[model samples]
Target: MLETLLTHVASAAEATGETTEASGDIMSSLGIDWQMLAFQIIGFALIVFLLGKFVFPILLRSIDERNAKIEEGLKAAREAEDNATKAQSKIDDQLAEARREAKEIVATAKDEATAMLSKADEKAKQNAKHVLDQAHDEISKEVIAAKKALHNETLELVASATERVIGKTHSAKADKAVIAEALKGADK
Candidate 1:
């Protein structure tokens, strides 16, 4: 190294046509070591080449595989979540339909019940009216029978009293006429 520095100094002095302490001082103050710099650059290149050829490819491949697996997992999770949401939506739609059907069924049942109740009330009213009419008819018949029985009894009593007063019995035809005339005057 010293020989190289001396040769560089001699060449520089020849070129400048002067020999100065300042030139040597300037070269030294720059603090550059050419051989060491070349060795450091070569070492750095070798380290870079080794890492790129051996270590970097392996690490990069592992990172790519990991990325692909993570992406696939994320896609599967999204699909599962979407399917769950769709299933829930379908269930909710079915539930809403069931509720609507239930409401319709309840309304139909209520309407049918109301109709049946109305019919029953109408039937009951008709039955009551029929019973009242029959009772009135029966009462009328009984009243007519009572009036005819009283008329017959009154006729018989009058006929027997006449027989006692006149000291004689009468023919059926004559008794009928006399009873009828007495009944007429009594009715007036």
Candidate 2:
């Protein structure tokens, strides 16, 4: 069966205008001799081992360093963002506090001004009352003086009329005594 298959394969190869070489000659011409192949394989294995052991490790270390630096930069950026947020919050709080303080100051000043105004009004009223009392006292004194003058004039007129009726010439001394007595009686 193997011979029949080989014959048929040969015929097929001839029909395709190609011939297959024997395995031994193919292997020898391709330099795939076991001993030489083994040496070549060992050399390639050594080169791969060296690259993996030294060069690859250095490359991985460099890649890791770059990654670490990138991560650190991201962390720093986050920290900066957080700090900025905190600063903004603090500024807002301070601004609000300032506004509150300003309002309180304004209110206090307004209250003080109102109190002062009220005090001024009270003082003005007191001063006006004092002035009115002094005016009343002065007017009362003037009225009393006028009434006393009128009473004296009435007595003088009566004395003159009585003298004319009796046809007596009254002396200055007598007139003075009479007026004095009349005034003393009216004093009661």
Candidate 3:
């Protein structure tokens, strides 16, 4: 395999008219000295190192600052959301408190109304009792008066009937007794 590769290389070199294997001639034909190429590569490497230390660091710092700003914005948004949640809770608490107060007020009003109705009913019952007592007393007095008047009238009728039957007037003592009896009945 090595012999085959060497023969191919020799054939290719002959075809390209390369009769000598010299590194200097190859370098000179390419217009590059190996020592100068090495120095130029070193200079490029130094320049890349300087840029990585100074300019690249500035770029990395800017990227880090941008990322920090994004993180701060996210934190602020989370804080705002928390504040909103607290505000909503406060509003809900206020609403619940208001509802409780309203219920208490309504209950108080209902109690007052019930008390008023109860008082009115008590007053009505008392008034009805007073009127009934007055009516009963008046009826008892009227019944006694009527009984006295009826007794007097019955005595007068009996005296007139005796006068018509015997043709004589009643005695004053008998009339006095009849009037006294009528008065006694009225007392009872």
- Which scores better on lDDT, 1 or 2? 1
How would the candidate models be sorted by TM-score, starting from the highest? Answer: 1, 2, 3
What are the TM-scores, per candidate, against the unseen true structure?
0.62, 0.52, 0.51
Q: What C-alpha lDDT do the candidate models reach, one value each?
A: 0.83, 0.82, 0.83
Model 2: lDDT to the true structure: 0.82
- Candidate 3 lands at a TM-score of 0.51
Q: Write the per-residue lDDT of candidate 1 for residues 54-74, one digit (tens) a residue.
A: 999999999999999999999
Error of 3 at 144 (Å): 2.1
Clashes of each: 0, 0, 0
lDDT of candidate model 1 versus the reference: 0.83
What's the true lDDT of residue 172 in model 1? 81
Candidate 2 wrongly placed segments (more than 4 Å): 1-60, 157-188
Off by over 4 Å in 3: 1-69, 168-188
In angstroms, give how far residue 177 of model 3 lies from its true place.
21
lDDT of 2 by residue, 77-170 (tens): 9999999999999999999999999999999999999999999999999999999999999999999999999999999999989879646777
The C-alpha RMSD of each candidate to the native structure, in angstroms, is: 9.8, 13.1, 13.4
Clashing residue pairs in candidate 3 are none
